[model samples]
Target: MVRPDKVEAVAEIAENFRGASASVVTEYRGLTMAQLTTLRRSLGDGATYRVAKNTLVKRAAEDAGVEGLDSMLVGPTAITFITGEPVDAAKALREFARTNQGLVIKGGFMEGRALSVDEVNRLADLESREVLLSKMAGAMKGTMAKAAGLFAAPASQVARLAQALADKRAEEGGAAPAAEAAPESDTDSAS
Candidate 1:
């Protein structure tokens, strides 16, 4: 039979699991109190860090509809429940782990798929959603501009050709009297 306190703890864990958009399991052994406090503060309000028992966490994960998280529930486990962007949460954890050797990432889960530690690191390297969208918009704009330039090239050439033809006709009209007089001189020489 489970105690009331244990049931409440499992319920709380289950709530966090349901609320998180992504979850990263980490090993926080050998960390000083100050280091732990700093790490929690660094994660900010968007993320919740809690040290939970493996069995309880497993039960919570199962209740929350997340499967395959049992393997990550190992020694000194602390799960970071993220409510905001998953990529940003991964970035934060990776950065924290880089500076603090005590905090080691085990693995993570995103969008119903279990990810390895390396996969989570790779996700951290990805640009933010806004940045990716801006890059795509810029690429599309550049392609459209190139197509417009290609479409206008022939029109520009046609305009230049028309101007040149008009100038030639003007020069011929201005010199027509001189051309006619030269023919008369040739006729007089023949006579």
Candidate 2:
């Protein structure tokens, strides 16, 4: 005697679970619909927040083969499915919770593992993936530039030394006085 609507809901939730890069469960007990809308808007394009019955969510998780989140599906749960970046979603949730105080971050699932509330907070503290990647790229570029300089330094120094020696020889050639050869000429005559 299962309702078609219920089955559909489960399927939708399961699909969301499958498609999300990460999922965070939060308790939004005291927030009104308006506040919820505001929270949703704040999550931006990378995440979607949905309110669902705990039973339906549980069933969906089971269907989706997502484990370690059953305990998090308690008490007026709203799940945030993140598709872009997990850190961005976590940061949005954390920021909203800090201001609203009604959005309680329960836990999350990411990368085939469960995240505790502390872990979620830690995730929020991290920089976005793009930022981290750019920093790493900058560091690698700097290292490469340094290596190139290290590889080229000795050759450049040797070239400069050779040029300096050549300039000295040229200057001596230009400054050659016939008087300096007088001693040699005198020795040759004595011989």
lDDT of 1 by residue, 48-164 (tens): 888888999999888888888888898889999999877777888889899999999999888888889999899899987789999999999999999999999999999999999
What is the alpha-carbon RMSD of candidate 2 to the true structure?
2.3
Taking all chains together, each candidate's TM-score versus the true structure is 0.84, 0.89
**Compared with the true structure, what per-residue lDDT tens digits does model 2 show for residues 150-190?**
99999999999999999998888876766578888999999
Query: Looking at candidate 2, what is the lDDT of residue 152?
Result: 100
Per-candidate clash tally: 0, 0
lDDT score at residue 112, model 2, on the 0-100 scale: 84
Candidate 2 residue 27 Cα shift, in angstroms, is 0.4
**Overall lDDT per candidate, in order of appearance:** 0.89, 0.95
Against the true structure, candidate 1 reaches a TM-score of 0.84
Report residue 12 deviation for candidate 1 (angstroms). 3.0
TM-score leader: 2
Question: Which stretches of model 1 miss by more than 4 angstroms?
Answer: 175-177, 184-191
State residue 70's C-alpha deviation in candidate 1, in Å: 1.0
